[model samples]
Target: MFMNIYPKAYISSLSDVKADYFKEKGIKGLILDLDNTIIPWKAAILQPEMADLLKGYQASGLNLCVVSNAFNRRVVGLLEPLGIPGVAWARKPRRKSFLKAMDILGTTPAETAVVGDQLFTDIWGGNRLGLYTVLVIPISKKEFFGTRFVRLLEKFVLNRLAKKGVIEIPE
Candidate 1:
């Protein structure tokens, strides 16, 4: 478990995620988390910035879909205008949702990347399924109590990586 594994992982800010970066990394498809990753958890509407960014990625020929654990219809509604179909009640960390997203995108595991803000749900699930994983800092620190607890573990992992120089915290 302490193996110095080569990272099929990366940490990035939401603002720093670019189409070119994905293209350069040879990622042909993206599986995105909805809440906190694209918008704050409480937000029912997609921010214009996120809409534009999604358009940019789509325009670059990157297949994109929102894969979220949220079962809310409002969450699914928000993604429709972006013309990207989404899967809610994704039940992530379970492999089923990730596999479903890949099926929708028509891409295999090697061609896909999963982008989200949580470690337990997003990273663990993606890594398990053999898709490249990107862990973004949550847009808002406030979350459900259970999520807050998982976040504590996330910070522990991040801190350990920082201390080892395996990952550098942004200035």
Candidate 2:
């Protein structure tokens, strides 16, 4: 039961996971979370360095799509410049959006990965479809009020997972 929310890997940030690493894992496509996963919470700007990293991933032959709970304008505004498609208002931890993203990427579950900061949304959503899941530490301390409440529970779960050797939390 606990494994459902557990990610296959956890890292400090998106930049830590390299293109070559994804290639080695046979991941040809990625379903990325927007807000905290890509930019800081509620922020639309994608840093130049992050943009370069994303472009490099694309250059390395990985298809990318943004799956966000935010409205269309916000998701599209940020990703349009990067030529990345997105599914906004994605009610994740549900299969529909993830399936839609897979369709957009034209990749099977085995060939795709979902990267995000939240376990309840991104990780759970990806795991449901057997997609590789990578949980990144939230980029900033600032976040939604509801998310702040969930983070308290998320921390407890992470501690348990770490103690069980299911994942390693950095000190």
What C-alpha lDDT values do all the predictions have? 0.80, 0.91
Residue pairs in collision within model 1: none
Candidate 1 lDDT tens digits, 1-171:
422222344556656767877777678899999888999886888889888888889999999988999885866788878889798898887789899989999998988988888777787888887887888878876688877777787778787776788753332
lDDT of 2 by residue, 1-171 (tens): 555998888889888778988888899999999988999988869999889999999999999999998999989999999999999999998899999999999999999999999999999999999999988989889976777888998889888887889974322
Where model 2 places Cα greater than 4 Å from the true spot, the runs are 1-3, 168-171
Q: Give the clash count for each candidate.
A: 0, 0
| Whole-structure CA lDDT of model 1 | 0.80
Looking at candidate 1, what is the lDDT of residue 119?
A: 77
TM-score to true structure, per model:
0.89, 0.94
Tell me the alpha-carbon RMSD of every candidate: 2.8, 2.1
Error of 1 at 166 (Å): 3.4
The number of clashing residue pairs in model 1 is 0
